[model samples]
Target: MIQLGTRWLVGDEPPSRLPQPVIDAIYEVEGELAEQGVDASEWSWTLTWLEGKPVVELDDETTVEYDPETDSAIVTAPEG
Candidate 1:
């Protein structure tokens, strides 16, 4: 079984497998972080599967939620 709370460093790979959409979501976050003057490899990602959907949360609390309806990844910025 996949662990409910898997943590991986920003530059490291998750030991547990992740869905393609989740990976795409991370990439989206990468670009956003870059624009914010943050290195993509300076933080970490935590994987959480909710209702069969993967939700990857970044160290700064940014999220990449998978939307099955659109078959796409949605990146949410961390709330101040």
Candidate 2:
């Protein structure tokens, strides 16, 4: 399992796949770090667990929760 900052990602073949948005986020962060001449791989990292399965959700609102253990992001819709 690869770790970056406080976020954790699960790497597994079959069924479990990394989300594109998460990957984009990582890349974005990586790019920013690179611009500063800082290598994220060399920085101190927090402990994070990989997920065993993929969990996805679609919501009309912009709220979500990240689960480290499951490596999942739960999103909730805004109440009208």
Candidate 3:
């Protein structure tokens, strides 16, 4: 897991403080990417909150939004 500030990530687990929701989001995104044939080693995760919503940014293109209410991640891909 990756830890940045208060966000704990599964792919890039850093030695920082993080919350439970952020951790769950990282794992969720990791699973989703793996199902798509993307390995965890091929990417990184950054967790943050946007307007009180947990957002996980994968690499520089993909953004996964975590909804604690539904316990799911909403992935947003970069546009070409």
Candidate 4:
């Protein structure tokens, strides 16, 4: 079970309990960073649980909020 404010450690895989779409979205962001010549190897994924939903944040300030109703992650680009 996921506890509130659970954080995914750096260099580790994301929590399996999260939805598949969320997982894919996370990977996509990581890939994007890599393509942009950013070395995100040491960055971690931060998970903030709101009620039963998950709001994932990256070191680069990108956010991925899960929407169960749509079965997709509402990805917000990193704030500049």
Candidate 5:
């Protein structure tokens, strides 16, 4: 059983405070992924702001290896 959540980076500190609209969008996407038979534990989420717009990447079959010290994460999709 895999259960995970998304993490975001704002300007200085990581974006912990997601806007209401963004939160709703994320939840909607999460539900769609779950319905597609995505395992919760296999989730690796990345939320970033580019050009002052938010972008979200999610995958249940993909694994994101992250290092907290370096603030780096690698996203890889396993072969099905």
Candidate 6:
């Protein structure tokens, strides 16, 4: 299980075998982060869920929620 903020994100399967839609979401988020100058080497990444939706959470409190139906990722930041 991975913890993000006050929520715990868990999965019952291996990451490598994640569904293609999920993989696509991960790639999309990674691309967005890269464009924003966030280096993959500089932060850790994990596949988890937020509000029942798959998301890629970054170490800096950045989250990219993936919507499989729309094949899109919604990026969010920590709220102060």
Off by over 4 Å in 6: 1-14, 48-55, 64-80
lDDT of 4 by residue, 1-80 (tens): 66667677445788988999999998888878878988877788999888879889988788999998989888899656
Model 2 pairs in collision: none
Report the C-alpha lDDT of model 6 over 1-80, residue by residue, as the tens digit: 54333222222222654456655555665667668876555456566655666666766677667676776656676787
TM-score of 5: 0.46
Tens digits of per-residue lDDT for model 5, 1-80: 33234463221222445444555545555565568875565445676554434455554444334433554444445576
Q: What lDDT score is found at residue 11 in candidate 5?
A: 17
Give lDDT tens digits, candidate 2, residues 1-80: 54332433222121124554444433454455568775445343122334533332212222333556665555444478
Model 5's C-alpha root-mean-square deviation from the true structure amounts to 12.1
Q: What is the C-alpha RMSD of each candidate to the true structure, in Å?
A: 2.6, 11.4, 5.6, 2.1, 12.1, 6.8
Clashes per candidate, residues 3 or more apart or on different chains = 0, 0, 6, 0, 3, 0
Q: Which scores greater on lDDT, model 3 or model 6?
A: 3
Q: Which of candidates 1 and 3 is the stronger one according to TM-score? A: 1
- In model 2, which runs have C-alpha deviations exceeding 4 angstroms? 1-16, 44-80
TM-score of each model, in listed order: 0.73, 0.35, 0.48, 0.86, 0.46, 0.46
Better of 1 and 6 by lDDT: 1
Our tally of clashes for model 5 stands at: 3
Highest lDDT among the candidates is held by which one? 4
Best candidate according to TM-score: 4
TM-score of 1: 0.73
